[model samples]
Target: MITKDIQVNCSIVERFNSLDSSGRLAHAYLFVGPAYIGKTETALSIAKMFCCEEKPTAGQLFCGQCSSCKKADSSCHPDINFINSDFGEQIKIEQIRELLAQVRLRPFMAKKKIFIIKNVENITLEGSNALLKTLEEPVGDSLLILTTSVPEKNLDTIRSRCQIVRFLSETKQDLAEHIRTHYKEDEITSQYFAYFAEGCFGKARLLQEKKWFEKKNEIIDGFLFKGWNDDSIKKVLEDKEQVKEVLDVLLSCIRDCMLIKHGIGQNSLINVDRKEDLKGFADRFSFDELVAINGEIIKTCKLLSENLNLKIPISVIKEML
Candidate 1:
């Protein structure tokens, strides 16, 4: 689905439009960026544009009323295919073979068949080799779009074959403002999603849908402020998904305390709702101590990303306090 506000990813669409207008569209494209940053959405939008029966010009977007647009929007378009890979699982060679076979056929309806492979970095080396054959030989009336959060994991040959498009992340403030204005969110709600989502609108929307912001006070007060007790850590660790959320909140709280120590304006603080409490916490530590704590928190977060044992990192964080 096209996101509610797509201005953040308009550059990709504009580039595609220019290419389509000039009749110079590439056979394959690689859209690389952080997860939930609109790479897939942009690919889907471009796919719809390619199939739009209205035949929009360079400056115009797809007409929603067209049969092709309706089918694409409803995910019923035969010519548009989305191949999704689950987390931690590599795309199989059989999947690549199926994709190759499908791409060999002519479009069922539209002028071109579009295949969007999400998380292409997860493709196994064998699968990558199979996919490479198709990329080497341009298939008839087909467009291949591959997306990956970690471009470094993708094969260099595959990367070289496609026209690479790099997506930039939005600023926290800009995202907060967008959420507040477009979603009719309150200032705190808007700021919460923006900070937690790390400037990704799609992530913000998912967090909102999950009502994750409701846990803000509980998480901060329970584990963060009191220096992550055994019970608090246990609760957080029980749900592996919440591990990152807890770390993000802990990092933000520490940063807020640092800001409070420096007498920074309240508006600059991420956890603005807890300004008074953070100020009190800040007074207990020296500036250098806070810096050290911040470093530990950053280190722990990195270790967690690498799938290291969380207990070791948590123990180190506990010692920091």
Candidate 2:
């Protein structure tokens, strides 16, 4: 049901247009960036362009009204195959074999066959080996597009075979504008979410969709006023999937407190809505205590990354409090 009407960065669009117009488009492209940063959308846009029935005029890449564009937009194009980890966390070798067989054939409708592989980092060693052969010698007029949030996880050979296009996170101004126009939020609220997102529009959108501000405020109130305890830790750890987000919010609150203690302006703080609460916390904890706690939180994050038991880090966080 998803569509590809969302506009990507203008610079990326221009770059692709230049390559396509010059007839220098690479057979393989690796789109690397953080999650929800339009890596897949960009790849799909290119695929749509390749399959578009009508030629695009200057400054326009694809005609969205064309039949080819409609098919690509709806993800129903015969020549465009989307491979991902829908079956499991790791893309298995069986899927790779099937893909190989399909790519060997010619396009059914479009000028070229486009294969979009999402989360290439999750491809197993066997699958990567299988894909290596295809990448080494791509079939006639076929295009391969791979997208990954963690490019480092992909094999060096795979990285070498593809033309890497790095996608940077959105700027604060861009993110704030998107939020204001899409989410109908005020300037201050939009800016706060923009800063909190750390230039990732996808993260900002997810936070808005999840109604994260209310939950973040509750967590901050409990941590600062109610104090840390076993129950408090349990509440934070209730959803293991959201642990990182919760930790990020907690870290931002700590940063706001530190900024307030140092006489920094409220505008510089991400938790601007809770400036009064931050001021109180700033007065309650010494600068040294705040620094030590911040260090512990960072350590906890590292431990979590290392796959250590979640409880261990949560307990350590409690002790720091």
Best by TM-score: 2
Q: How far is candidate 1 from the true structure (C-alpha RMSD, Å)?
A: 2.6
- Give the per-residue Cα lDDT of candidate 1 at 190: 91
Reference-based TM-score, model 2: 0.91
Q: Estimate TM-scores for all models.
A: 0.90, 0.91
Candidate 1: lDDT over CA atoms? Answer: 0.84
Candidate 1 lDDT, 96-133, residue by residue in tens: 88888889999998889999999999999999999998
Off by over 4 Å in 1: 1-8, 55-59, 224-229, 315-321
**Model 1: which residue pairs collide?**
none
Model 2: per-residue Cα lDDT over 20-129, one tens digit each: 77999888889898887777777787788778888777567777888888898788999999985532388989998988998889899988899999989999999999
Indicate the residue-level lDDT of 12 in model 1.
Answer: 78
Task: Kindly report the root-mean-square deviation of model 2 from the true structure over all alpha carbons.
Answer: 2.8
Give per-candidate clash totals: 0, 0
